[model samples]
Target: MELTYLQTFREIVKWGSYTRAAEQLGYAQSSVTTQIQRLEASYGAVLFERYGRTMRLTMAGEALLPYASEMLRLHAESKEVVSKQSAGALTIGTIETLAAFFLPPYLQAYRRDYPEMKVNLQPGNEPFIIEAVKEGTMDVGLILDPPLADPELHTVVVRKEELVIAAHPDHRLGGLAAAQVRDLAGESLILTEEGCTYRAMLLRALKEEGVEHQLSYEFGNLEAIKQCVVYGLGVALLPRIVVEEELRNGRLKAVPFSHPSCEFYTQLIYSRKKWMSAAFRDFIALMRGGRGEASKMHE
Candidate 1:
């Protein structure tokens, strides 16, 4: 009848060994064995059958799996809800691009506005961040444009950029004001690994144009790619915001082209069912107004 006993039964069946389940649960093996015994006695049915080192779930245990899992899930969800209602720590998810450039200033201004708010930022690409917010693991997410819409999530446009080709200072097309798509033919290029929305878009464009190039290197970190470019490795196509500092410092050059410039937009996304605190409202309002007003000054 005790929830802990049900939880232990589920864990024992899940792991298939009492010792392994004990290690996972941080309990002694004897303690784990006793817990299961108690559960079986209370339920008046054998829950597991031991075969050598492994424990197989009996019919009674198999029948109880779904209900036990749901009970734990509901308990966890209830705890999370209560915690959020009491202490207002907002967890925001974001992608590396936005986390690097956009978040710092906004976060600084936000902290000044609401000093009491505890804000946690979780960084991931569009898919990961969207799932976090959709599942209530994150309060909000600043992400690249996703391919599909989630009815549970509401998205507001944050900022947009025109993607440009970039090359090291020493590359032949480096100093040029702009280069045609064909100019990059057969050149060694740097790109991120797959699952990146922008990289996928760039690949699609390249295939459509029949441009031949060598993807000589791939990097998981943006900073490493920028450093590689500074060392005169190869060219890359990236959002301007990501390389603004390198561009300003003369370490890299943006190669404009007659080809269609890839347009990327950042979206402020959150679940429609989420309860926005005072801090959340202020942060959203600041992003919507601040990004545009700040850009006009650059023009």
Candidate 2:
């Protein structure tokens, strides 16, 4: 099948209509229909089944989806390899805290060094970032304590961040040098929403210690959780980087946890099969402190 035919097929499947796909691809509706017919003729299988006006993918179409995506990706990579332009786009997925506290300087440096390269930063929780990287939608991901058994992705520890239990300055744990994991039992806790890696780690630690606590509030934003903790609403486990200002101002106190797992890591992750462009490589080097000659750009 021709690349254009496969492109039309993919677009049609995505939009679920020849008219819409044709509109998107700047082709006539009849041309879109003809391209799908050619693709179906080549495969000798019905790719889509029509139910009134709505078209859905058949089994054959579902099976062809991944292969079509791979072929398109390979085609783009091959073009990039042969192209003289060294600068391209890089999309990075990260968590909110890292986007706010950790990535600003690094990203600013990258932009200065490669002015022609476009950088897209998408912030979300760990699971969303991980999935984006795995699916090839994101060029890289900065995640926390990634899974060891994910064979499709490669990860390196870029930074070790301290995790601290923070409470209002007047809270009982504020005066202690270190609090036991069991001390959290029955205490009101403000935590990130479910599926957050740090929150999951905290829950796992609590479960391991057989300490059950009240999850008093769940929030998606780190700042909201910090505000809640600062006002004595509840205690929260957070990265030290996110609460440095509060801790310094004495608005919140870091209740050091006795558990050894209180320390966590920020890991740089990407797919193992990804083609590392020069810009992408430099971005990784920047994150790892191997800036080399690129450091001059910051000056």
> Candidate 1: worst 10 consecutive residues by lDDT?
290-299
Clashes of each: 0, 0
* lDDT by residue (tens digit), candidate 1, 1-50: 77888778777875799888899899999998899888888889998998
Clashes of 1: 0
lDDT comparing candidate 1 with the true structure: 0.75
| Best model number under lDDT | 2
1-299 in candidate 2: lDDT tens per residue?
79998888877876788889999899999998888898999999999999789788999999998788778778878887887546777889988888998889998999899888888888877878887787676889887763333778877667677778899999888888888888888899999988787788778988987887898999999899999998899999888889999989889999766676656778888888889877777787888789543221110
Listed in order, each prediction's TM-score against the native is 0.69, 0.79
Q: Candidate 2: TM-score? A: 0.79
